[model samples]
Target chain A: MQDLGIRVLLEGNNMIRLLDGLWVTVRISLLAVVISIVMGILLGMVMTLKNPVTKALTRIYLEFIRIMPQLVLLFLIYFGAAKAFNIHISGELSAVIVFTLWGTAEMGDLVRGALISIPKHQYDSSAALGLTGIQIYRYIIIPQTLRRLIPLAINLVTRMIKTTSLIVLIGVVEVLKVGQQIIEASRYTAPSAALWIYGTVFFLYFIVCFPISKLSGKLEKRWQN
Target chain B: MSKTDYLLEIKNLEKSFEGGTKVLKDFSFSVQTGEVVVILGPSGCGKSTLLRCINGLEPIQAGTILLDGQSITDGKTKWSQIRQKIGMVFQSYDLFPHMTVFENILLGPLKVQGRTREEAGIAGEKLLERVGLLEKKDAYPRQLSGGQKQRVAIVRALMMEPEIMLFDEVTAALDPEMVREVLDVILELARGGMTMLIVTHEMQFARAIADRILFLDEGQIVESAAPEDFFGHPETERAQRFLNIFQFEK
Candidate 1:
């Protein structure tokens, strides 16, 4: 019988290493989320462009990003493309690039949905006030769009944080990978250490993601009412 | 038409939809300064179309709309500058849902007129007071009733300080109890000497407040007269029948 008691917390060094790994995971997700939001807003605007050629090009890119698996994307950028193009890409850089690409496609879809959901009369009213194109966007369009996009954007951040665990499959030492390494080292001492370390890692992820989900829900309810 | 004498002059204005169905054909009218003109028409009579064309919202297929001796349809006119002097109110009370009543009123003045925040706020507060909605200045459009929304929309347009105001059936969407409140605001605006053009089905309000009434049917103004004359003795048989239909409803 394995004693899954306070022995889990008896190892201070192990807990410190786990926390360090968790910090790295958070840093990558935060950087990727910011970059993705900026890129997504620009791409979403381009998606709404009236030119057929540009619209078709953006559509193809969106479809490509949607269908490809995130791990596959990581492998392609890290292994396939880097080898094919004779460029050196590190594991961490590849993880960031893959997550950014995935996050951007999803965020861009959110932005487009929010922008199109505004009532048509809003545009007409802005024009009726004799506003120029730039003024309309600055004063009328962006403000209303941002009001709607904030809650959804926060939700996307929580998703991006959880998805960062997938980067461990490609050799980045995130929290999950740190747990794996600890269990492998302790396998001779206790065969069930794998279950204990991985369970701690799962609780760590829950702790990190739950606050953001709560915040988003609260904001959505407050704004909607 | 005498140039430099009229505030606005329309000559044979015509417009058609995609399939070449004419909406306005050979329409002509003129308005002098401070004149209140009411366009009394049934539904889909091109009255709103005529108002939209004068404000440059819709392009005319043929004919010229002259504003202060300059033609608006010449393809060289700066519509934004021309539109700065004209304000319009729609039937649906299209207020910005995300903005407070005060922000909605000040947006035009601050953005278009380049007024400072202090100046815009002063003007906005005064306009809100004029509409009797000063208490609701910080409320969003969703918080207001239908009549309050229309009144805020009116104040927002008035904040532009336009020389001419266009009302496209402003009270058509309000409840019976709410209709008089909006009409009262419009009646006050007319009394204050705004160059106004209105389209309405409320004949009693038209009779009470209109300086001159024009009866439009199909696409043309079949009769134009003062309120007493147009209501007392309509000239054409079509005009007589149109008036008689309303009379039978009463």
Candidate 2:
């Protein structure tokens, strides 16, 4: 019975380590999302310009981001590019770089969809008012587009946080990675320890993501009805 | 007065759509200073196209549009300068939805003329009062009825202090009860001696307000005369048929 009590206490220490890892994961995701939104709005606006070559380049970029899996992108940035360029990037830094690239592409597409959904008559009316292109964008276009973009972007942030778990594969000591290490260290004392540690990790992710998901749902419902 | 002394002149204007539909061909006319010219035509007759070309919103394939004797369509024409002197109001109010009534009216002056916020504000308030929308200055376009929105659009155009103003069916979008309110504002503008070219379907407005009227058909001016002469005894069969359409409804 004393041996059983020590095993349970050991499992509790693993749960604490996993929680610490989750803090790192959330930190990286929040920073990446902020950077992505800024880059995405600028890139999306440039993509909508009348230049054919720029438009084609942005199309190719969006397609590449869409087709390449995030894991492959992570490895390419962490292992391949870092070596080829002789640059030293920590696992956390590489995870941020890869996720920022991915999130920017997704956010930019959302911005494009939001911008195009605005009626063309809006432009016509602004032009009729003798508003130049810059005034039209500043006074009329951007505010409306941003208002429609907020909920979608919040949903993307939640997606980014969830996807951050995949970064553990690149050897970042995030929540799942810490959980795995804990289970590996305790394999001898308690075989059932893996289930408890992983269950705790699942709840940790849900705790971070559930509130954002609920916020998105409420905003969508409010806007729709 | 010589035609060259007119406030605006259009010569040999031609426009075509991408699908090869010829909308306007060799359309030409002129408006004198302080004159209200009502352009009468059926739908798809290039009336709106003419207004757009004059404002430099739609580029003409071939033409010369001179405002105050300076050619606006010449390759050397400076758009920003010419646009500063001319203002356009659409059938759809097109008030900036994101802005309050006061901001909407002040945008043109503040941006184009580089008026300070305080200067634009004073001018904006007066224009709003003229349009009888001063109390709704804090309201957005979505908050106002269609007629009120149209009035805001007119005031927004006027805040630029344009040398000439174009009205493209301003009352066409208003409810019948609201039409008179917009027309009353327009008549007051006419009495103020502003140079104006209005495209409208309101026959009574043409009869009561316009100094002269031009009847267009198939993108060509079929007749041009004083409103009394044109409405009383139209020369062309097209003008007669055009006037007949307005009569049939009433």
**Model 1, range B170-190, lDDT digits (tens) per residue?**
899999899999999999988
Q: In model 2, which runs have C-alpha deviations exceeding 4 angstroms? A: A1-16, A27-39, A46-101, A128-130, A168-172, A183-225, B1-4, B75-77
| Candidate 2, position B201, lDDT | 93
**lDDT of every model, 2 decimals:** 0.85, 0.84
Docking class of 2: acceptable
Residue B163 local lDDT, model 1:
80
Off by over 4 Å in 1: A1-12, A67-94, A188-196, A214-225, B1-5, B16-22, B72-77, B116-122, B217-219, B229-250
* Model 1 clash number: 0
Model 1 CA lDDT for position B211: 87
TM-score of chain A of each: 0.91, 0.88
Best by DockQ: 1
Decoy 2 TM-score against native: 0.81
Root-mean-square deviation of Cα positions for candidate 1 versus the true structure, in angstroms: 3.4
Candidate 1: DockQ? 0.44
CAPRI verdict (incorrect, acceptable, medium, high) for model 1:
acceptable
